[model samples]
Target: MKVAALLIADPEGPDPCRLVHGAPLLRHAVAGLLASGCADRLVVAVPKSALGDCEVIIRAVPGAGSRCRVLACGADRAESARLALDAAGESADVVLVHDVARPFVPPATVRAVAEAVLAGAEAIVPVLPVTDTVKLVSGGVIESTSDRDRLRVVQTPVGYRPDVLGKVCARGSDPLSDLPGSVRTVAGHPTALRLTTAFDVAVAEALLEEQG
Candidate 1:
């Protein structure tokens, strides 16, 4: 199966070009995907202003020359995803959408998501079991306590068949939402944590140092 991965870097979000572990976070994501060998093609959607910078970053990754394409993303996440899907084209049988912010996503997780799509799963998402206590808060008051065992924290490189994703995108629907087909889950790695705040960046840097 021909797999295509979409890496999105929203303009409104934290700077994807921010250096982490001696390389831009976006570069890390692109390199990780390339290292995984799960996709036949890689389509990166970045902020309009960062197009040229992103192109340079992607080009710097070894073995990314022909397989990677960088383009300006849409205003919102769904639109950005749709634009990337369009860029991925009809040749790709499976599509995986991932956040560029989650630069430490394990290559094994990437391969697993793609493999599940190849195996017959209509839609796939890697998820980690929620370990924190659950609480329902309304305004400032705690409403109730819920079960955490049934909860799962969703992670990316979400996989889908090309046609299914196309239809979802065409309708402007979130790909992670309920779709026409069943969405299956696979084991997620802690390294796949989505980076958002400065604290998250600090944690990622700490992880990198520990690994080295």
Candidate 2:
């Protein structure tokens, strides 16, 4: 099965291009996906202003030159994902929508999601069991508590059949819940933590140090 990976390197966020472990976070995401050997092609969606820089960064990865394609993204994440999916084109049978912020996603997790899709699962997402106590609050008042055992923290890269994903994108529907087929889960690694703040960056740096 031919699989394609899509990454949205939105600059407006916590700066995906920020250095992590001596390399840009976007570079780590690209490199990890490539290392997975699951994606036959990769399409990265970046802001128009940062297209050149993003392209350069992706090309700098050891094996990305031939398989990676960088392009200007749309106004929002949904649009960016749609455009990237279109960029993946008809040739790609499976597509994985990944967050560039989660740069340290384990290659094995990537392969597992892809393998599930290839093995007849229509849609798959890597998820970790939620360990924290859940709460529902409104107006700063505690409303209810959620069952942690039944809750899972969703992670990327989310795998899907290209056609299924295309339909969801066209309707502007929620990919996780509105997907036409059943969504399954695979074990996610803690290393797949998303870098959304300075604290996350610090944690990722520490993780890198530990791995070394």
Candidate 3:
């Protein structure tokens, strides 16, 4: 099956997706997808202004130069996704959208998502069940406690049938908030945690050292 992956890299951020251990986070994201052999083509999206810098980074990764290309990311995550889908063409049977911030997703998770999509899933999101006590609060007042068992911490490499994804992308709005509610789940690994703060980067660095 023809599958394609889109790794979203915002051009600006408080914790910009830049180099870690001598390689850009986008490169790490690409290597995981490439290693998985799940996506036939990979697209990395950065700000239009950063396309040249992104190209330079892609070229540094040994075999990535051939399998991956850079796209100009849009103003928001939704638009960025749309931009990637457009560049990916309509030939892909399945498309996986990954966050550049979540740079260490295991290849096993990527393959699992692809296989699930092939096995008749329309939209698949890998999730780690919430284990912490959840709460709802407003103005420093506790509203109610949430059911932890019913909560899931969603992770990336979210998969979709290309047609389904294309339709959603066509809306040109925030897919996360605008897409239909139906979703499938696959187990996620801790290593797939997203990098949001400096602490996240530190944790990832430590994890990488252990993996090595």
Candidate 4:
């Protein structure tokens, strides 16, 4: 099955790009996709402002690195992603959306999501089990404890049928931040390692080494 990966890059050289995490993070994602050779095509989109930066990334890689077609997209995340979809053109049987911050997406997880879709599920999301007990706070009072098993910590590389994702984008604005939990769930990869802050990046780096 054909698959596409959309990387929503800030392009302004955000903290994710700093020496600590940025370059390594993108490298991790691209390397995995390249190695997987799972998708017929894989592409990355950065804001027009960040095109130069992405180019620098390609230049550093040993291969031609042209497999990932980078683009200068709109200001918003959904817009940029939707633009990538438009450019991808083929509307592959399945489409996988990933974030640069989540550089540690395992190839196994990628295969799992694809399996799910091929198994007839329209959408599939990857999530890790939460280790910490969660407290539900209501009106400043502890409501109750939550079952960690029932609650999964969603990760990125969420797989969806291209048509489904495109339709969702058409119904509303490009998928943006502050989406509902369910919406977020649809966007996680089972083996995803999100790099939001400095600490997250370090954890991801450690995980990558272990994975390697």
Best by TM-score: 1
Candidate 1 lDDT, tens digit per residue, 42-81? 9999999888888888899998999989889888888999
Instruction: Pull out the clashing pairs in model 2.
Output: none
In order of TM-score, best first, we have 1, 2, 3, 4
Tens-digit per-residue lDDT, 83-118, candidate 2: 888887888778999888899998999999999998
Q: Ten residues in a row with the worst lDDT in model 2?
A: 173-182
- lDDT (0 to 1) per candidate: 0.87, 0.85, 0.81, 0.64
1 or 2, greater by TM-score: 1
C-alpha positional error of residue 179 in candidate 1 after TM-score superposition, expressed in Å:
6.6
Tens-digit lDDT track for model 4 on 1-212?
Answer: 77776666644434333554345555666666555566656667765655777667755655426556777766666777788788777658877776666666767777777667656666677777787989999999999998877887766666667777777667555443423333433334434756666677667667656766
What is every candidate's alpha-carbon RMSD to the true fold? Answer: 1.5, 1.8, 1.8, 3.6
Stretches of candidate 4 exceeding 4 Å from the true structure: 10-16, 20-23, 59-66, 173-191, 210-212
Off by over 4 Å in 3: 11-17, 176-179
Total backbone clashes of candidate 3, pairs 3 or more residues apart or in separate chains: 0
TM-score of candidate 1 relative to the true fold: 0.95
Model 2, residue 91: distance off in Å is 1.6
